[model samples]
Structures are given as C-alpha cells and as structure tokens.
Target: MTRISHITATAYSCPFDKQHQLAFGLGSNVKRDVVLVRVTSEEGLVGYGESHHGQHPTAMAEIIERGLAPLLIDCDPLDNEGIWERINRQQLVTHGLGAASMMALSGIDMALWDLKGKLLDQPIYRLLGGTRKKTRAYAGGLALGFLPPDTLQAEVADLLQQGYTAIKMRVGDTPARDAMRVGHIRQTFGDDLDIAVDAATRYSLGDIPEVIRYCEDNRVYWLEEPFTPDNLEAYAELRKRTAIPIAAGENHYGRYAFRSLFEARAISICQADLSKSGGFTELKKIADMASAFHIAMAPHTSHSVLSAAGNAHLLAAIPHGILFEADVAKVNPFRTELAQPPFGVVDGHIEPPHGPGLGIQIDETMLERYPAIAGPCYLPIERSAGPTG
Candidate 1:
C-alpha cells in the first residue's frame, strides 16, 4: 500500500484584468484567491486540489502546511474515506470546525480523490459509476449586478447568444432594482429561459418579503443565500413567503451543519462548493442526505479549476444533481490555468473530465505566475449596509 509521501499547500491570487464590480457580496472582486494542496504518493504520483480561500488564502495554506499535512504524510492515500475520518477525528477536533480548518481539510480530501482516480487508471466519474457524460450548466457571472437596465439586458442577451439556456445574475441592490431587472429579463426573453438570482447576503429582514413577492410574480429559479446561513430563523420564515426555490450551502461547511439546514426546511436546493464543504468524503454524505429529502442540488463553483472539476464528478454521480455553476468571468487564471486542459462548456452543458483523476493535470507554472496578493478580495463591510444576521 502506497502511503502519502509528501503534502504541501500553496496560495495563489489572480487579479482580474478589470475588477468585477458586484452590486453586493464581495462587492468588487479585484482578485481571486485559492489555496492549492498537492499530495504525492510513495511511488511519486502526484495529485492537486484547491480550497476556498475565503479571502484568507495565506491562513488557509498555513493550516494545511502546519496542521493537515502531518496527519496525511504517512497515511494511505487510497483509504479515501478512512483518511477523511482520521483527519476529522484528529485535526478537525483539535482545531474546531472553523472556516480555515474545513477549507483545509476539503483541499486534502480532493487531492486524495484525484490520486485515487489516477491509481485506479480511470477518470473520477467512471470510478463513481459514471452517471452522465455531460451535465446541464448555467452561466454564473459576477458582472451581472445593479448595472443599468440596458447593461443588464445586454449582458443577458450576450450570454444567450453564447448558447447558455440558463444564467444566474446578482440581486440584493435594493428590492425595487432587483425586481425590475428580473421582470424585464423575463418579459424580454419569455418563459423558455431559466433565470436565477443570487442575493449574496445583501438583504434586510424586511427586504425578504418584497424579494419573495417579486420572485413569485416573475418566476426566479432560486433565491440564493438571500440571507447568510447564520440566520436560520429568517430563512425558515422566508421559505414560507414564496414558492421560488431557496438555495444555499456554499457557505455551509459540513454534513452536521447541513443536517440543521435540512431540519429547518429552509432550502429547497443545496448548493455546496466541493472545495469548501468537505470534498468528496463529506460531500457524499451531504448528497446522500439531500437525496433522502428530495431536495435538488446545484454545486457552486468559483474560479478554481480543481473545485470545478471536483464538482463535475460529484454532479455526475448523484441522482439529485440539477446543474453546475460555471464561472463566466472575463479573466480567471485559477479557472483557466490551474488545470491543464481547463474546463469547457459545450452545447450549454459541461462534459466531465475524461482524464484519470479530477480529469485535470495541475500546471506547476501557476505557482510562479499568480503567487499570493495581500489584502481582502471581498467587498468592504462598511460599503455594505442593511441587516446582517
């Protein structure tokens, strides 16, 4: 049995060619952060994966370099689930389930899966029983925000021209503006198109009802993270206000927290990020829970290719999988260069990686090209007002 020979986590920051000015949530993404973890087998095989940096890439990398790597070094890489349990029982217990710890473990879990697929000489999807070759995907653009109505309409039109049947646009710029954008898009495009609005935790307690009414009247596919996951009570109440699917989970870390979300009955769709949630190990348990509850799933993908490929494999294997989020940003090196072949959306759907492992080969040059940029990449809090639970 080959044991994990070496493990290291490196942080990278890729600045967008132009800053992404969002109406809310991380208000303007000037740069994207990702902490990549590499695990080497005793035989010299290597695998790569990424962790959601949460605007703190350096800190997340320290957890892997100083905390998680030790637990994994001598362990068998193929005991995928067993290694996950060991990490949970050891490091996670000692560190507590904080964002950095969870994100760090997620990176490790993903690397092990990539290594496993390589070991088995099969792609991750094929190893997971190969649910489907391609899964339906929607354009996920951070640029679609509280811009002018013409700008917003033009953005939608351009995406549709690109063959995207569905798209997600940012809301929470005030209920009136959000409502008008949704209504205009629906009126212009008609019912055949799918439109999802992500509030990005920019709404007040009072804003919930107005947004709900708008979604109900206009047919918004899902109101994503209308409020932060911390406000479970608000989410439960908001669920009663509308029939449009309430989607969340990218912020949620593990299955224990998801159990609470399921109990709350607040979310109709669970949108976990593989690199943030718990990678394949814990995600399988979460997906199983969603299946039992009949809740649909839509995995969130930012700019990390590792997370994107990991998400595609999970989406393909699960029965409840609906769609995967694909970043449509103009400049995203993490999405383009982190993986050798990168990810592509063909015919409005993404074809699963056919390569062994995450179906991605880690490009070492990204380490030199992107490096780490300092300061917060998310929106400044003072710039954001209204209730934040």
Candidate 2:
C-alpha cells in the first residue's frame, strides 16, 4: 500500500511587473499566490498540486499544514473518494473552515490524484477514462482586463495572432465603458471570434440589462460571474432575461453548491475551478452532475500550470467538458517557470500533457526564488456602481 507518507502545502508568490499588472473588477492583480501541495508516498513517488490562494496564501497554506495534513498523513493516497469523505465528515461538515478548508483539501486531493496516476503508470486523463483529444482553449486568466478600448483591442489582436479562437475580457468598470470595450473587440474581430466577459462578481441585479444588451448585440459567447456565487436569485433572474449564457462557479466550492446552481438553473455554463472546487475528485462528480443537467463545463484555471494541467486532463475526460481557460497572463511565473510541459495552444486547441500524472515537473528553485509575499494579493478598491444586490 502506498500510504501517504508525507504532505506539505508551501505557498509561493511572484509579483507582477507594471506592464503585466491586471486591473479588473476584482482589483489589480499585483501578484499571483499559490499554495503548492506536495504529497509523498512510502515508495518515493511524489505528486504535486496547487491550491488557490483565495486572496490569502499564508492562511490557505496554514489550513493544509495545521488543519488537514494531520488527518491525512497515513491515509491511502489512491482512495481519493474515501479521503475526501473522511475530511468532509471529520472537519469540513463539522467545525471546519468552510471554503478555506475545501481550498486546502483541494490541493491535497489533487496531489492524491497525481499520485494515483503515477502509481498506475497512466496520465490523469487516461485514468479518468478520457481520450487525449484536443480541447478548445480560451485566452483567459489575469489578462485582457480593464483598459482603453483601443488597447484592449490590440491585446485581443495579439491573442488572435497567437491562435486563440476565443478570449475572456474583464468587465464591471461601468456599463458604458464595458460596452465600449466589448463593442470594440466585436467590431475589430468581427463575428468569428468568441468573446466572453467576466464581471468578477462586481455587478448588481440592476446592472444586468445593459450587460445583456451588449452581450446579445455583440454575440458574446457568455457573460461570466456578474454576481457572486451565493447570489443565486440574481443569477436566476438574469438567466430569465438574457439569451446570453450566464457562466459562473470559480468561487463556488463542492458539489453541493453546484447542485444548488443546477437546481436553480442559474447558469448555462459551469466554470468550476479544480484547484478551489475540491480538486479532481469533487470536480469529476460536479462535471457528471453538470452533464445530467445538460450544462456544458468550461473549467477555470487562474493560477499555476498545475490547475491548468489538471483542468485540461479533467476537461478532456469529462463527457460534457466544453472549453479550457488557458492562462494567457503575460507574466505568470507560476505558469511559465514553476512547471513544465507548458499548456500551449495549437490551432487554438490544447491537448493534455502526455507525461504521467499532470505531465508536469515543478522547479523547486522557483519556490525558493518566489517566496510568498504577505498580505492580500488583491486590495479592495471601491468602484462607482449602481445598486448592488
């Protein structure tokens, strides 16, 4: 038995340069933080996974090291479900730290899956019974954000040249400003390109109609997370009024919340994050549930190549997996230097890395080089907006 001999969650941070900084509805992304989970087996096999910082890298790392690791130290690494349930029952459902607990476990669970793949001598997609078919990739992450219309258009042009058929832009600056950006991109690119806008949970229920009008007019692929995940009523209400697909779920945790999203029929697209939504074990269940509801999934990858690679494998494996949110951030070391088999695009589609597990090799040197920076990655900034829900 390859018992979990050791587990550690180490947080790393890489600050953004002035050029690469992305100011969006979520505030400026001055730096990227990730909690890397490394799980060691008795037989010397080590697997790595990433937990989203959730704007608090140090706290997230503490959750893994001080909260979840003790409970999972001796558990079987291959029994992903059993491990998940054990944590859920023992801590998560009890007096555990809610989303933070899930965020911590997410990285650990992903490491377990990585270990499973290595143990079985198979890549994650193959283990999940998914073919290595190429999935469509969208240029996303902390780029294509709030900028002048011409500048945003130029950025979109660069992405198009890079062979991206689709791109997601940040909105919620204001109705007129957002519309101008979207309209400019639409006009410049014509109808062939797929444009998705992420509001980053910044909009109110009152802000829906204007967003929908431009989305419909420009034939936007989807309007994502105009409101926070807990605002189910707002999502449901917007869905009723718009032909544009309402997409969300990156901030949502677990299958239960997703089940509620499904039951409410709040969204036509699911954007679950493997790193935050309970890793591969829970996300697989969420993907299956989404398929039953006839909703297509586009896995969200906001951090390092671990989540990007994990999402690619899971998306390739799932029946209803639709698109891949390729991190197109200009200066993300976590994506560029921290890992390998870079999630590249070919003719605007990305196939899973062919190596065993996540097909990644982390550079430990990068960890030492990019030590975690203290304080919040995104500082709160008040924005002028209409009535909020």
Candidate 3:
C-alpha cells in the first residue's frame, strides 16, 4: 500500500483577456483565480486536484498547507474514505468549520482519488465505477453575461460553432435587462440551442419573479442559484414559481447541505462540484441522494483542468449526470497550461482524460507566472465598494 508522503498547495491567477462583470453585487472579475493541490505517495506517485479558488486562493493554500497537510502525512493514499472522515471530523464537525475548511478538504480528497487511480493504473472514472468513457458537455464560459446583446451573441455564436448544443449565461441584472439578454438567445438561435441561466444567488424573492417568468417564457433550461444555498424557503418558493428546473449545489458544502435542499424539494437538478462538494466521496453520496429524488446531475466546472477532469470522471460514473460544464474561454491559460493534455470538447462531449489518475500534472512552477492576488474576489453585490474593487 502506498502511503501519503506529502501534501502541497499553490495559488495562481491571470488577468482576464478583458475585465468581466456579474450581476447582483458582483461588479467585475479582473483575473482568473485558482488554487491547486498535490498529494505524493511514498512510492513517488503524484496526483493533483484543484480547489475552489475563484473566491480564496491564498487562504485556501494556507489552510491546506498548515491545517491539512500535517494530518495527511503517512496516511494511506488508498484510504480515501478514512482520510475524508478524519478531515471532516477535524475541520468540519469538530471545529464547526465552514467554506474554507470544506474547500480545502475537497481538494485533498480529489488528490487521493487521483492518487488511487494512478496506483491502480486506471482512469479516475473507472476507479469510480464508470461504464461510460465520455460525458455530454455544455459551454459555461465566465464570458456570457448581461453584457451588450451583440457581445453576448458573438460569444454564443462561437460556442455554437464549436459544436456545443448547450450553454449557460450569467444573469442577475434588473429583471428587464436579464430578460433582454435571455430573450436574445432564444431569438438568435430560435430552437437550435439549449440555454441555461446562472443568477449567482443575486436575487431576493421579490427580484426573482420576473426572472422566473423570463426563464419560463423563453424556455430557459434551468435557473441556477437564484437564491443562496442557505435560503431553502426562497429556493422552494422559486421552484413553485416556474416550470423550469432549479439547479444549485456548487456553493453547497457537503452531502448534508444537499440533504436540506432535497428535503425542501428546492432544486430540480443537483449541480455539485467534485472539488467543492467534498470530492468523490461526498459527491457520490450527494449524487445518490439526488438519484433517489429523481434529480439530474449537472456539475459546476472549476476553472482548471484538475477540477474539470475530476468533474468528467464523476459525470461518467453517475446515472443521473445530465450535463458537464466547460468554460468556453478561447484563451484560458488556466485550463490549457496545467494538464498535460488539457481537457477538451469534441462534438459537444468530453472524453474522460486518459491517465492513471486525473491525467493532469500541476505545473507547480506555473504558480510563479501567475501568483495569487491577495483580496476578496471582485464579484460583488450592491457594489457600494469592497476589497475587490
């Protein structure tokens, strides 16, 4: 049995091609943020994973380094379940931890799964019991938003040309503004494209009625995160307001968090992030829970190959996986630069990366070219001014 020898985390960021904007409180995104983790086995096998660093790159690096790394040394890399429980018991249940701890554990858990795949000489999906080798995908660029209608249309056209049958656009502007953007998608493609909208949890119950109406009227596939994950009542009410499926879970922490959503019948689809929802262990539990409730699985893509490959593995294994999100950024250095052969789409589907593990190797030195910026993410609400600005 290969024992875990060491753990390390690195943070990176690159300025976007052009600044991007979000609705609700999020103002603009100046850079792409990422934090990556590496787990090494005593036999010298190395596996990589990506944490949710769009929000806290430096802090996540620190937590994984100081808080989690010490606990991982000498643990069996194959003891994924046991290590997960230990991390959960220590960082989650014991400390009453929240997002940071969960996010850090999520990355480490993925590293272990990757390490397992390497040790067994199998792809992570196969290790996860997958029958399929490829998974359906959708374009999920951070670029599409309530930008000028023509700008958004150009972004949509390119993705369509790339053979994506489905795509997601960001929302959360004034209802009428959001309607115009979503309405353009319907009119531009007529029925050729499947469109979904992510509100980024930017709306109140009052702000969402019109948004819900727009989604329904325009055949929006689903409305994602119209309310925060913690707001179950609002999510349940939002579901009742429209026939379109309600999707969330990226912001949700664990299977326990997802259970509350299930109990409320708040979400029609579960959009768990393998890295953010407690990696493979917790996500499998969440997927099973979603399956029992007849909910679809549409994973949220983190902006790196490590998480992207991880998402694909889980998507291929699960019975309920409906869609895999891919950031359609034509020039995303983050995705292409990290993995040996970065995950790519062919005819609107992603073949699970071929390798013993995630099929990705973190360019640890890439951290130097794109060091983490120290501050809150630029996404804002009410934009009165915050650390991001």
Q: Could you give candidate 3's per-residue lDDT for residues 1-389 as a string of tens digits? A: 67889999988888754444333325666677888888999978888887887477898899999998898799988988899998888888877447788889999998888888889899888888885467778988565865678888888888888889998888776677788888988898987689988888888988876887888889998888888778999988877877898999989989888989898999999998877889888898899999999999998888788778888888888888988898876556778887655567789998787777887666665567887886655655453211211
Worst 10-residue stretch by lDDT in candidate 1?
Answer: 380-389
Best by lDDT: 2
TM-score of candidate 2 to 2 decimals: 0.97
Reference-based lDDT, residue 81, model 3: 88
What's the ranking of the predictions by TM-score, best on top? 2, 1, 3
Clashes (backbone N, CA, C under 3 Å), per candidate, total 1, 0, 5
lDDT of 2 by residue, 112-206 (tens): 98988889888999988898988899999888887878788888988899899999999888877788888989998899999999999988988
RMSD (Cα, Å) of model 3: 3.2
By lDDT rank, best first, the candidates go 2, 1, 3
Query: Whole-model lDDT for model 1 versus the true structure?
Result: 0.82
Q: Tell me the spans in candidate 3 whose CA falls farther than 4 Å from its real position.
A: 17-25, 379-389
Q: What RMSD, rounded to one decimal, does every model reach?
A: 2.8, 2.5, 3.2
